[model samples]
Target: MADEQIEVLVVGAGQAGIAMSEHLTAAGVEHLVLERDRVAERWRSWRWDSLVANGPAWHDRFPGMEFTVDPDAFASKEQVADYLAAYAQKFDAPIRTGIEVHSVRKNDGRPGFHVETSTGTIDARYLVSATGAFQKPIIPPVVPADAGLHQIHSSGYHNPQQLPDGNVLIVGAGSSGVQIADELRRSGREVYLAVGPHDRPPRSYRGRDFCWWLGVLGKWDMAAPPVGAEHVTIAVSGAHGGHTVDFRALAADGITLLGRAEGVDGDVMRFADDLRTNIAAGDANYLSMLDEADEYIARNGLDLPEEPDARILGADPACMTDPVRELDLSAAGITSIVWATGFANDYDWLQVDAFDENGKPRHQRGVSSEPGVYFLGLPWLSRRGSSFIWGVWHDAKYLADQIAIQRSYQAYDAPALAAH
Candidate 1:
């Protein structure tokens, strides 16, 4: 709130930013967090009605804090939003919501960074880009131009029952797409799941969450799941819902699985001629990820599933979602198309030159390549699964230590570095 005298400036007050801010608070460091909307507003408003976190409640805990909510009761999007708010309140973290930061640039000669926002300009020694990857929606370019084909991106999808009475084709086999497909099928709307590389699982793997296996192993840790450098998890998207309709179980329940959509011509959603191949590829990817998870478990000292939990439930090695149709636009009575495809990480609004060949900031951790700039909360920053709230806790601590070490104390104010 002071005039150009803030000690630390944090951008994007989401989970990563909050985690970083909490450390600053414990250190008695004065700082400010800028967010475009209310904290966790996107999570609160964007999720679909039937959405429930895939992982157990224990998975959502913050650093230095336990998620005391029901461990077995998976939280809906709304509940998770409230929990984040409560976490912020618990630490009395200083955040200014509804304030969008436009750009971040280094101050010419100062030992600090500069940021321009809707409110005003801020100068601080460190900047953390906690703006996550799920902020923007990605829609396929070749979708049908039919005025009748109703489609919505998963981000805006609130409730499936709100859609009309007709056959629904949920594209993409990611958690959102598959989950919506199952929900629509159960509600009696003929559902078609246009499958892609999906992460499918057994119905009930040995009475424990299949995810428990990964956690038991170190796959979710630094240097785990990634095939390249340290495994940095992009985003922990969703859990394999054991409570509701499992995607694997839905295959037997008569929900149709189709090949990837070739393109939609009017109401006739055309699919690639080779539906079986697409299904096989998707299934194979899921199996491989499982194998990688299992390999990590065996390497670690975790106890193995004695009775073979993975195979307890039968799997349809041949399961696939099929038949893309070229629908008649006006005749089909469809209004829109929901692109449950996924999200892309965008940083055009961020006025900096810190991105690498992948358009991502090159950082040792959250500390950016630039002198006084840093980033946090981008999935898989340093190791596998580091993007999740559960993972961010560890990363935030490491990054805070990085920031603290970078801030060397001096006897007097040198007009270069400010210590409070």
Candidate 2:
């Protein structure tokens, strides 16, 4: 392949990258989008066949394209992939699939960037890393390799029939864990879920979907508070037939609820005795949100239909009982262990010296410390919904504006530099 020079190079042809390319095209800037795999490959390969987006199709619209699906219907993973493919086609985005970006670094003593890819090299004046936030699956290092149990991350899970016929133990009570546990239970597999600290908002509240309230209230567009030492990872899901995934419901369905898994000692799995505390925290957050929503309704004097108290929905007598503290995986016939743990951002392939000690890039909004480098599609990049389907346009537009400004400056300064 011949070395090519472009005005801008955007990496990762996912939602964020496509958005950025669209913006750049509108700005009349020449840019190329590099993709390691096919468009929406992560959505196609990483998700289970039964997985649906956690939000309604109406709430997932991107710029220039509104969802045509039923407003309240959650789109399956396949539908989402198809939607993205159609989006790319509608925009005529200059996306090169199957070209892997191996490194992005400043061209030494040059005024541009050297972007190394599997195909060849490309020199560009600006670079944007549009890789989605969750690039790496985070499995616990404490998992013993020789534990004699079939282990898989949620990304690797497809269906229960693929697993050996036996009970299953799922660690991490986040959205993935809850949804997967529900699916496994429906498949007649005895399942045990490890509870974690999470936010449990009702799927529907006050005659509207919870996400509808969030959107109407401008919570997604609102700026987040200053970063603290620890960021809270809220776990909520819309996979339960458009209802919240409730732990009490799982317990009522004969699926055992365990405290947070502490560690594994041979076949014995120990749990933190904090199941009740975690439940209380989630309930408190849910009630707090409800209170805020009620205040908004009253302040506006809007006559929305009154709904029943949400506290009654997840009420189950068995949930309040002390959860099991330990379990023998071998003795319980638990042949498979599903780790629904969260993901990590991978920047090891990047050869730039722009990241901090924690491996996160030092950036304000999407602008990186490096002069011509930027980032997109990261969680909390600008707001709480920055990583969502509806939030990326703002960041992409901002970056495109900046790129346009730089291009104009370079054009103006070219003659001056040549004179020197």
Highest TM-score: give the candidate number: 2
What lDDT, from 0 to 1, does candidate 2 have?
A: 0.83
> Compared with the true structure, what per-residue lDDT tens digits does model 1 show for residues 1-420?
324657778777777778888888887778888888889777777788767776767665674665555775567777777778888888899999999888776677566667778878777767777887677798888764444456678788777667766767677766677777766767777666666544354323334554565566546765534353232112223434344224456667766666667765544566665556544554554466557656665676557564344433346534333343444434534344567777787887666668888887777766777766777877668676676787787887887777677776522465765767
Give each model a TM-score.
0.82, 0.94
Q: Mind giving the per-residue lDDT tens digits that candidate 2 earns over 1-420?
A: 229999889999889998998899888889999998999899999988799888888787685886667878888888888888899889799999999988777888878788788989999888899997879998886559788888999999999987998999998887788889989999999999888777777777787778778877778876664344134445566674688667777888878888888888899999888888887877777777788788889999988888765656556446357567878888999999898888888997777867998999888888888888889999878887897887888889988988888778878844445554
lDDT score, candidate 1 = 0.66
Regions of candidate 2 where Cα sits further than 4 Å from its true position: 225-231, 313-320, 414-420
Can you tell me which runs of candidate 1 are displaced by over 4 Å? 144-146, 201-204, 222-248, 273-275, 278-335, 409-420
Q: Rate the local accuracy (lDDT) of all candidates.
A: 0.66, 0.83
For candidate 2, the TM-score is 0.94
